[model samples]
Target: METRFLKWAEILDFLILIGSSVTLVAWIFGVPLFYHADGPVLSIFTSISLLVIVSLRLATRHFQLWPFTANLAFLMIVGGGNISSILMLLSAPAVHINPKSTLVMTSISTSIGLIFFSFYEILLYLRRTPNRFWILDDILIHLALVPGGLSLIGHIFQNPNYLSMSIDPRVGISLLEMAFMALLALSTVLSNPNLFLWKFLKSGTANQLIFVGLFVNQYIAPIIYLVLMHDDWKSGDFGPELFIFFGGVIATLGFLLFQAKLEENNSLIRSGIN
Candidate 1:
């Protein structure tokens, strides 16, 4: 029953992305949703990010491609955690979104997907389907990503001030760079999972080189550019800043540790030695 629900959740989450067709269109227009930069540099960088993400999607059928899938999902999940839009639908006045109108539309859809995907991954880990849920690897990922995503769901959806929060462009871009680093670390750690995709990836040296290069270029490089040019190197009280940025890391680690304890107890029961 849990497994079935998880599968449905993944389907529904993907459907949300599909519903946000505008994002895909904007992606094609060389306009990456989160980055609000203009000019040729942004155009080229977003184009490459699109190229890599699309490639990851294409390879999903035959290979696990968790790196790509997870990153894509993360993009959708974090694009815009704006609460004002939902609040507006509930009769509250609409609030401004930092991203442009077109981008905001897509980001809203992505933001909504967090609730479903986070639950799906949790069920996947708990269900422990053969090698599909390796304790060491899956734990690390869920620890880093799941809790962070879910914890912020409330802030994005319920807090009216969330969308209105002021952030230094440089800070936002730097935070994004840190996100890319977490993703890269995830990809490296789970590189050799026991799966069919591993065999395919291991066939030649070219695959590794291409995958790593695209990983950096498609995801990391753009953020580097964004932060470099993004200005406002200022400091302030920054109250909610902790929740906005590093919340995911703290949540991930805490939840995974607790879940690990539960899984250990469940394993003992399954083995019937106790």
Candidate 2:
């Protein structure tokens, strides 16, 4: 029964992705939103990128085409592509998608990626499904993201200033990334799931190397961009929402990790006593 429900939930997620792609394509066709003025390609590529991620997920259920790295690559493509989009909106003279629309894209894309990530863990990795913990991800998607995403889609169609907005105000959320894999992939996989990567990476040094690389690329690189190099910072604009979002996520993740560790230690104690 639990497996049955997950299937339906996955289908709904796919449908939402499809609907969003269709809407985004239509909007771009009507009013092209380019990543660069000299190069008008990214607008179209966004939809293509979305399709590719979905297709990859469908094609590899058994970890056939490389289990660990595949999804990370997909996320890199998605995150790397969309990360700069917020900055485009924050730049002066307002040359990118409207702040309202940008906010929508941020919420939708992040929410979708997180939903997929959580589902992958719940359905494939976790031993228990449909637990009380599942409600956390559900709240993120249903309560906050879905409504905002729907509103953005509706607003894009009606606004005359569709791709135009004032970047004159120095206030906009900087995009921030948090990669648990970089921080604790080893801990997560080696927990109750007892999962591990291919044998080649199971060795101590190799895993450490990968962890360091991912930490630098996924966590450190983005922090540098958001803080020092981003246009928003250069323009003296800063929105506290993204910081709040980042903070809440990190705090929750920390608490969860602590709980998992405590549980594991308690289990070992029980086993020893028996």
Candidate 3:
């Protein structure tokens, strides 16, 4: 019964993730009723994604592979992405359409969420990993703060007009963010020089395929952002930002899979010796 319940829970979580992804894609592509001003579809999708992420964290609590504190820190990073999106959506009317004091407040809250989450990811990378990629991750995480923190401060000082002048600064900061991810991808590939060879020599397993997906997404996100920043740097285009944020998700999942493979290899070696 317990196993069956767990299976059902997993299915539900998968469905929720799929639903959120679909809605987000639709919003990005300007699907009918998705990019509208009034509906709460984006908010609902973000909220459900956050809940699913939280549940995954809880389910992994007993695994004991890494420090719970580190996992919590990672979860906080994930939560930051969700909260920032919701806050931006809620505050959109105030800044662009309606301009209400309450909406300004919501925007401020969202900025804070971004700040906290960005720092949390940095802190976790520094505390948990001794790999060369760790240093790059830490620096990039800090670099991400420049635009985000400034945006928050801009909101506080100018209220509804905060996001108005934030575009150039954000674009500059995101350039650094992209560079950081590029470094991460390079470091990973260099560290595991055989990663690609292994996948090619053997039929790519599910996990290996996921790793490839992550690598591609990481690089693709930064490149796309660079292009968008060049073309639409004036209006605070969020398309690239959203892509980079999800790129971070892909990077995290890839790191987790790499760790699992390392553990599995170690276990196999130990069993052979025994």
- The top-ranked prediction according to TM-score is 2
Per-residue lDDT tens digits of candidate 3, residues 173-234?
12222222233223222223223233332544875676567546644555455455555543
Pick the lDDT winner.
Answer: 3
- lDDT scores for all predictions? 0.36, 0.38, 0.40
Candidates' TM-scores? Answer: 0.31, 0.39, 0.27
Clashing pairs in 2: none
What's the candidate order when arranged by decreasing lDDT? Answer: 3, 2, 1
Give lDDT tens digits, candidate 1, residues 157-185: 33222222232121121223224323433
* 2 against 3, candidate with superior TM-score: 2
TM-score of 1: 0.31
The clash count for each model shown is: 2, 0, 0
Tell me the alpha-carbon RMSD of every candidate. Answer: 17.5, 14.5, 17.2
How close to the true structure is residue 44 of candidate 1, measured as C-alpha lDDT? Answer: 25
Q: Which stretches of candidate 2 lie over 4 Å from their true place?
A: 31-50, 62-72, 86-255
lDDT of 2 by residue, 102-199 (tens): 22333223334444443444344323323332334323322223222222222323211211223321121111111111111222233212222222
Q: Cα deviation of 143 in candidate 3 (Å)?
A: 36
In model 3, the Cα lDDT at residue 211 comes to: 56
